[model samples]
Target: MTELSAKYGPVFSFKCGQFDVVVINQWKFIKEALANEHLLGRPKETTIPGVIEHASLIEMSGESWKQQRRVALTVLRDVGLGKSEMEDSIRDQIKSFTEVIKSSEGKPITVADKLFLSVSNNISKLVFGQTSAYDDPASLLMAKMMPEAGKMKFFNVQQFMPIIANLVIKLNLFNMTEIISHIRKFESHILDEVNIHKTKNTDDNSIKDYIDGFLHEISKRQNEKDSTFHVNTLQRNAALFYFAGSDTITTTLQWMMFYLVKYPEYQNKIREEIKQTIGLNRQPENVDRKQMPFTMAFIYETLRHSSLVPLNILRRATEDTKVGDFSIPKDSLVTFNFWSVHRDPNLWDNPELFKPERFLNEDKSKAIKPPYLIPFSGGRRVCPGESFAYLQLFLYLVSFLQQFEISAEPGKDIHLESVQNFVTRKKELPNLIFKSVD
Candidate 1:
């Protein structure tokens, strides 16, 4: 797409089976298109076989999308999404995560698995009101399942040719059987959690977690016509929260570690900033970010370089829409090529290079994140967990660097190339040695 964008201009459309898929390569067009109300729809559930039968927050359109997004934001805030309480929760998880690293005792160990579980536990605390033990069966299963799930192309032939895709699903071909089976198992797990939440005495005043808040909403709206709150939506949305909140953050953290080891100078620079701003005696706090510009810049640089969600969740045109001069017909699939934007030479100097200084100001006293960097994306359909993701990334990176020096394992080659999936990009990370800074 990035190569094609140069020849065809930033906004280009191509036919994919029965649909005209539009790709916006530049941030200007992406911003305009995403902010437009007519382009906010998601592909129909029938077109995506393995997705929840009923659309979750990511797939819902129009009023249902608005309602679910509103409720989700509210519930997230209620559960301390941006509050100090949430920071405390993440810090607690960070402590556990650091212990796992510390116990490695300078041995070469792959941290992705532990990182996945630690990140999952953080989300588990918000959605379930409790953290899962690293050895917990359910947590381990989910940590194992998430990466596989991320690799699946939920919008493949299914989006372009629904008839053939449906036939393939019915015949259990192309691994559709296993895909659907895994999705069903995931749904069943969420349903079990929902059922457990139902047993609790939930009310508006007694809301403790996402489940509590959602259950209360269901009860309040049971009598309303066309109500969107129900067991199916709650189950799917809960799963969405866990998946969205965990996988991407874990991948980003993995990239952070990879980069830190790859560029030890920057890692040492970040540690120095942590030492100066946060000190060695205490854990890094959210407020300290303002004073630690280089550290924040490094985090932003990793996000831009990784382009984790390269082509963000595909959006559909609910009505005929004009993205700049291009006319998008209703039902057309519109996606922004974030990879192109992040790597666009016009917007970034030496776009291919990984330099945290690009995000710093003249005196290096402040970090300047340009409007073009849309790692979490933008507009109404933007990631709901953006704030939460940032908090976790900042806390995890700062805390991890403060206590340990990360480097590649002995006699091992470090591979920084990303394995591009249909949705998110992942690193085939090498095992690294972590020596305690103390």
Candidate 2:
């Protein structure tokens, strides 16, 4: 960090290929970046091409971001995040995923695709109060929507280079207008959900999904003229759930199975513990996790090895700031070096090695440590879906591992080089064989 800081300076600028860019590292510097008024300041509908737009999501910088973040936090709590009710929804998705595996009849399944589908379905249900039973049209539509959505580049070229942007726009190079159309289609689906939730008398019944919680808040704050509360906000949030929920959990699951395949000895160790603790014929639950420490350790190792956001998303600096003699100017784009943190050699013994024991103990006295575990990133912008993510990952992993014996197919490997797009996704879908032990 010191080396990079010296070269970049606190507020110095650098060029990327043809575009100028700003980099920030210090925690305080980054926080200042996210508070910049002009950074996310455009009217929600007049947003730059290809980004998710929520009307009330205008760039407020300081107090606005803080207030909005608090509202989001409260909404998560009110909607039962980190509670048993959310766990039940997760378990239901796990059951759905298990059924998909069961129908495979000992064939290799696409681990990435199946997990993505399942995780997306689970979160969609929570966010929209609409459920998808795996291959439903809604699920299929979203699966199709995501990849294309990722390919659209609105903020990159335009935000980075305003001069070339005018040229790009004139030549009809990248269609900002089309991305909005795609967003319109996406919002259409969310509105369908919002309309259904309203018709269902779910408010009175307190159905307790994200949409329910958001709408309730909207009603509470309706009379407040300055509030950003609205039905469209609910729609955008519903769509955002699909964005936030699906990919990270899917990536983590892929790495989990990848390590298990590469290290059968560790796999056997986890299985042995699972058997000794709960045995077969019993459904896996969150409570079972505490008894299987080694199993949890393997999960952590996978997260370490699979640095999901290699470059991570950019945060804009709000003010001219100093970080150890460097001055990062206000409104400058900031890249959190989460990737560098994860792969820091000073933090790990042999950082490149696939060692689950690094998070557990080969010797009980000198316990293994997690050097840099930023799978979900951290701070104000840290993922809001983490509780649901852990629940989905836990239920699916426990249920699948306990019920099946997964093995790497002959000459095939589950590689971890998934290209990072809007959200990082597998370069190719992961295919793994499942042999039922049930």
Candidate 3:
């Protein structure tokens, strides 16, 4: 990375090949830009298809962004983050996931769709009052489009015309109708959850979820002279939280299982460790993870090698900032390029290997791992549902490995290629033989 930056940082203004791109890792400048005024929800702009949309806050300058971002972070904290109830629900959801798969009686399965159903359901339970039932029309709609959305940047009317871009976009008649239909459907789902939050039972701590807390916020600022906090923003952020958090983590877990089946040696090591640590019939808990070090390392290696969320977060510079020798212009896009850094040969011994041992330390033949892995990402936009994701991921993988071992089908391709773009997973569904270990 140092070598690449030395040769390319200045040349970035030219060779990076995009108007808003800032190449390489610049943690301080990037973090500053997130909290800065230059792009914190101000003068909006247009983005063509095939890119990640710069955050809504990336347009505001100075004081406005500082104020808005503070509100956003505060709201996230107020909601149930890293709390016990959410993790408990996630653990339950994975158990539900097992029941669903077990009904199929060890048949080869497309576990991604079902696992996403459970994870997304758990997220919805936390964010709103209810979860999406499997086979719901709305669930099917989003599932179809999520991969499409990630493959290419669909139109973003809000970024272009904050006020009436919907009206402006009407000039295009045909495609505009489809876009509007999807947007309304999306908004309607969120609005329904907003309403549920409004009516939550305040009498019980058993309420234990985001909606109850948000309803409290609605009341908190109801009498305040002018409050930036609104039911609308809370609703939007809640929907965004569930969608963003569930997709990437579940996708990575599904792919990890795919690869585990592909490489039986790795799967056996993980299975052996789970058996030795917890034996059979015991559920995996957060504390038990320390006992399953090899299994934990396997998941870590999967996160790195899969590089599912391939791009570092999109940060638009708020003020003129210096990172390395180059000057990053205000309001320009500042990308962290985690893909590059994660794969950097300088930092890793064999940058492309699937070895999980790199993360374990013991005798001379052993390895040591770092704690600052940013798979859930970092900074303000780092996922608030990260704790839930950890529970879902750990329990789902550990449970699946403990009960039934998966293997690629005979005469089928074991080297299943992955789908890629902003984030990714296996293109081919991992239909595998799940022989019961019990």
Best by TM-score: 1
Give the Å error, residue 267, model 1: 0.8
- Candidate 3: where are CA atoms >4 Å away? 1-11, 14-18, 25-80, 154-179, 199-208, 222-226, 364-368, 379-381
Ranking by lDDT: 1, 2, 3
lDDT of 2 by residue, 1-438 (tens): 335755765344576534334655443454454444434322112224235445333233455556666776676676666778767877777777888888886677675556678888676766665567666766776666666666644246755555465566566566766655676777787788788878775437584677777777788888987676688666765666677677667767776777777777886787787888888667677777777777777776776677666554555555565554666556555565555555566677787888777776655323243525766655556666666666666677777777778887778876756666545555776578888875
Tell me the lDDT of model 1 at 97.
Answer: 87
lDDT of 3 by residue, 1-438 (tens): 335556765225432333356654533433444444433323334232212132233333355445545654554555545556656766777777777877776677777667778778766765665677778787766666565556542123433233554554557523555555665687688778666555555445443456566566557678866554466556556656667767877787777877787788987888888878887688777778767778778877887788776665455665786664567777565555555556667667797777788788774233344633556566555544566566667778888888777877777867757665567666667487777786
Q: Would you estimate the TM-scores of all the predictions?
A: 0.96, 0.83, 0.81
Local distance difference test, per candidate?
0.84, 0.64, 0.62
- For model 1, what is the C-alpha lDDT against the true structure? 0.84
Cα shift from native, residue 63, model 3 (Å): 6.4
In candidate 2, stretches whose alpha carbon ends up further than 4 angstroms from where it belongs are 1-20, 24-60, 150-155, 158-181, 201-207, 362-371
lDDT (Cα, 0-100) at 342 in candidate 3:
64
Q: After superposition, how far is residue 378 of candidate 2 from its true place, in Å?
A: 2.2
Evaluated at residue 108, the lDDT of candidate 2 is: 70
